[model samples]
Target chain A: MSARDRILGAIRESLGSTPRDTAAIAAEAAALLADPDAIRPELAGPSLTESFAAKAWGLGTTLDTVADMAEVPAAVSRYLAQYGLGPGLAMQQAPELTGLDWSALAPHDTVAPDEPVALGLARHGIAESGSLVIHSAPDNPILLGFLPLHHILVLERRRMLPHLEDYAALLGREDGIPRNAILITGPSGTTDIEGSYVRGAHGPGFLHVILVGDEE
Target chain B: MSAPAPQAGFKARAAAAIADPTLKIAIDRTTGTAERKRAAAVAAFSEFEAARARGKAIKDHVIAHLDHYLETFERNATAAGAKVHWAASDAEACAIVVRICREADAKLVTRSKSMLGEEIGLPHALADAGIERAETDLAEHIIQLAGERPSHIVWPAMHRTREQVAELFAEGHHPPPTAFDPATMVQSARHELRTKFLSADVGISGANFLVADTGATCTVTNEGNAELTTTPPRVHIVTAGIEKLVPSTAHAFALLRLLVRSATGGELTQYTTFHCGPKRPGDADGPEEMHIVLVDNGRSRMLKDEFREMLRCIRCGACMNHCVVYRQIGGHAYGGVYPGPMGAVLTPVLAGLERSRDLPSACTMNGRCAEVCPVQIPLPTLLRAWRGRSWRERLEPSGLRYGIGLWAAVARRPRLYRFASGAGVRLLRRLGKGGWISRLPLAGGWTGSRDFPKPAGRTFMELYRAEQSGKGGPS
Candidate 1:
């Protein structure tokens, strides 16, 4: 017998069942897919944006609040200046960030192999863990998030969810999950050497989130 | 295949670990920080208990109906252009991975940390097939350079000091530095592994959770090496145990809630990427082909046994961090890929009781492992179960058996027990010097470590009888 057949057979014999009802299995799986039960953690702040920023800051992610999308370049420039970095930034060709006035920041269309900064747009933000949800597509490439010294994520405050469960609910509404939907909490780090945490292990050393269009 | 015979038994290994002051200090510092951080992380979640309950329930439900979920995962994964392979044993799994790499004409392979990969000896298998593999995770890289197996599940190089790591880097890489700064060492490894990541033909990683609903494989990592290992190569291979299957993304998140907090005391890992499948037709980055190798090894048998709860482990490493015995001896003393409280119970199940019979006895039965276990695995109960099995099979030494038998016989009769205890105490008092017994026959094991306290002048029964008779008041 094939490995699959033998393995499944062993599992069946152990479970003491043979060929469960397909319809029943499908119904169970579908029901779970539709509305999965989860325990959502309550946040400290009154609004999702504040809660997200507070939690994100705790995780070592720098945060900047912008009143509108047009101010993103200025925010990015200010952040770059604060870090004593020059004005060259790599970014994806997403519609949300395409027409911005990035002249001040000298935004590049393609991310360099050793790009010091990269900007990307977040599809959603999770409040409980302060994670940015980025969906991989042609417009928003996945590498923009990982292959830079600094990662600047532009997110709309309205897209922030209360917890991971709410993000799952949002995915349920979509036709199909994307090829890659990453939930990144902070910059890369490791405690491998004698349990000392050092940031920027094969990913961005710093994470900066730009929250735009707040509730007020 | 059975695990290779340990270089030495648990007693000898643990003795050496205890003697090594450096190992003790490293283990103390690392596990101490891990425990403190885990406490704070769990406390941050007001619903930690509820989340743990739901996580356990989800895992139990999935394990009960695993066949259905695996089938669903295979179907959905295939639909998303990922090839799924099943392996009933370690050899088959390694062979499948080798075949895939060979077909892809892979020369340099980059790998993220995978305990299952270690269990199957994937690196050895690939080496036999003439493929060079680079371990990208910093801890794994250190161990690989040092030519060692992982001591701890989460912290593979917990046994190594920063000085040792600096030495290994100097020996293994070019332009070695003189200082032993962790930050500099990490930056050096990042630069070295970055070349491998860009040039590798295939990337291999392990999945923390496999979502059946979307055919996505999720990996949680603080270092983000798994992301690099998965994205840069033309082909990405995920070697996961069959038990890693969860019903939905929501269930995955529920378990993730406990996994990160319990493992490293982080709210979430730096990166929790869910790779649905291979890159879509216009995707700018991602592997063109993806493969999920579901390894059974000995898990299927475990699923049917009384020790099935062992399968619910999320590899959090909390049990070891809080375990008294594990805290003293470290992971190398266990003489297995996995160590600590979880290893004590699991190594026996996977490797068989005859070879690893001493593991279950290594625990102090403090029950701390169960308390901190995110999935609520009754670890002490499982350890005791193993001991019972070993006793029934007479796996213990005949000397021990006869000794216990004698004790049981004497304890069944109160008068004989009282007489024996009284006589033994009096004799010990004679032999003991300055209120401490420096040595004793048949107890050299206990006395070898420290001096044994002398027994009181009288047995409890003697004092009790005197008090009852209203004789000179008992002290």
Candidate 2:
């Protein structure tokens, strides 16, 4: 017998059940996804954006809250100049980011092995833990999130959710899940060496989120 | 012929660890910081207890219906272009991975830290198969270079001092680091690993959770090594246990919330990625092929018995962090891939009660592990259960059995208990001149290290009875 058959056989033997009812089990599993009953924490703060910003900053993520998406390129330019990093960026081809005319800084679509800076747009910002939810797509290559030394992500304030469960519920309702759905809470870090915190272990050493808001 | 004695030799190993002052300092500092951080994080989360309950409920449901969830996961993952393989044991799991690598013509493999990988002996398998591999996680890389097993689950090099890491880097790195600082060491590793990430044929990682509904394998990592390991290679393989299945993404996230909080005292890790399968047609950069190998490796046997609760572990390292005994002796003394209170209970079951009997005795039953456990595993109860099993099977030393037997005999009769206890107290007080006994028979374990405290002239029952009678004559 195949490993799968043997393994399933063992499980069935342990459970003391004959062959399981696949259709019934499938329906039950679907029901679980449709209406999740997992208890979520009651977030204390009134504003998700503020809570997100606070938590993000606590995770060592620097940010610039722009009045609108139109000002992102300039804000990103100023931030890059402040950090003394080069103007070159491996920016995602998403429409929201593509519409912005980044005249002051260089932008490309691919992330090189030693990409100094990469720009991607976060699909959602989790307020509970200060995380950015990014999904891989045609426009946004997954490497853009990992290869850069500095990853500058734009999370529109409207995309903010109260908790991780909210975003997960949204995912549950969606027809198609991305090949990769990632939640990045902070700049990559490790306390492996004598328990000392070192940022940028393998991923981006610095993560700066541009918290874009509605136009005034 | 009888098999070799089950190597549950925790006492001798713990003694060696205790003798090494440097190891003590490393373990104390690392676990102390983790404990403090976890305490503060748990305090900040108002619903931590509720979350723990929910986490336990989710795990309980999944484990009970593991076969159904696994089948569902297999179907959904296959739909997403992933080939799911089942392994009944470690060798089979390693063999499947090796076969996949060979089929892919893999030469260099970049691997993220996976405790399951360690358990299945992946490094040795890869080497034996002639596949060059690089460990990308900083701590895993250090331990990999040092040719040492991971001491802690989350923090692989939790027992290594800074100087020791520097020594390893100096010996292992192509051109040793000029500066031995943590940041510099991390950067050096980053630089060294970047080439492997770019050039590797296959990348392997462990799943933190397998979402049955979406067929996604999720990995939680602070260093992003898992991300790097999974994304850039031509082929990506997730080596996970069959028990990693959860019903839905929501359930996975709920557990992830508890896992991160209990684990480094963080709100979340730097990267928590969910990959369903191979890269889509238009995806610019992800492995073209993805494989999920679900290894049973004795977990099936665990599910069939009283030790089934061990499957609820998410490998968060919380139990080890809160264990007082683990804090003192460190992970290496456990003499298993897993260590601490969880390991004490689990090692005996996996390795067999006879082989790892000493593990259950290593705990003082402080109940801290259970208190901090996100899944509410009742770790102390499980440890006691193993101890009971050991006792029943006569797996423990003859001396302990006889001593416990004698004590039970005296305590069974109230009158004899009182007489024996009174006599024992009087003898102890007499021997404990100047308030301490330098030596005692059948207790060399206690007195060999430090002086045993002198017992009071009266037993606690006698003092309680006197106080209850309102005499209070002891004073």
- Candidate 1: where is the Cα deviation over 4 Å? A18-38, B1-5, B430-436, B467-475
TM, every model: 0.95, 0.94
Q: Write the per-residue lDDT of candidate 2 for residues B239-300, one digit (tens) a residue.
A: 99998999888789888879988989987898999998998988877889999999998888
Candidate 1 colliding pairs = none
lDDT agreement with native, every candidate = 0.88, 0.87
- Which structure among the candidates has the greatest lDDT? 1
Task: Report residue B346 deviation for candidate 2 (angstroms).
Answer: 1.2
Residues B1-475, model 1: lDDT tens digits = 1122377788888887787888888888789999999999888787888778777777787888888999999999999999999999989999999999999999999999999999888999999999999999999999888878888899989878888889899988766754569988998888888889889999999999999988999998998899889998999999999999998888888888899899999878999989988999888889999999999988888888878888899999999999999988888889877899899988886688998999999888889999999999999999999999999999999998999999999999999999999999999898799979989987887787668999999999998988878965545
TM-score of chain B of 1: 0.95
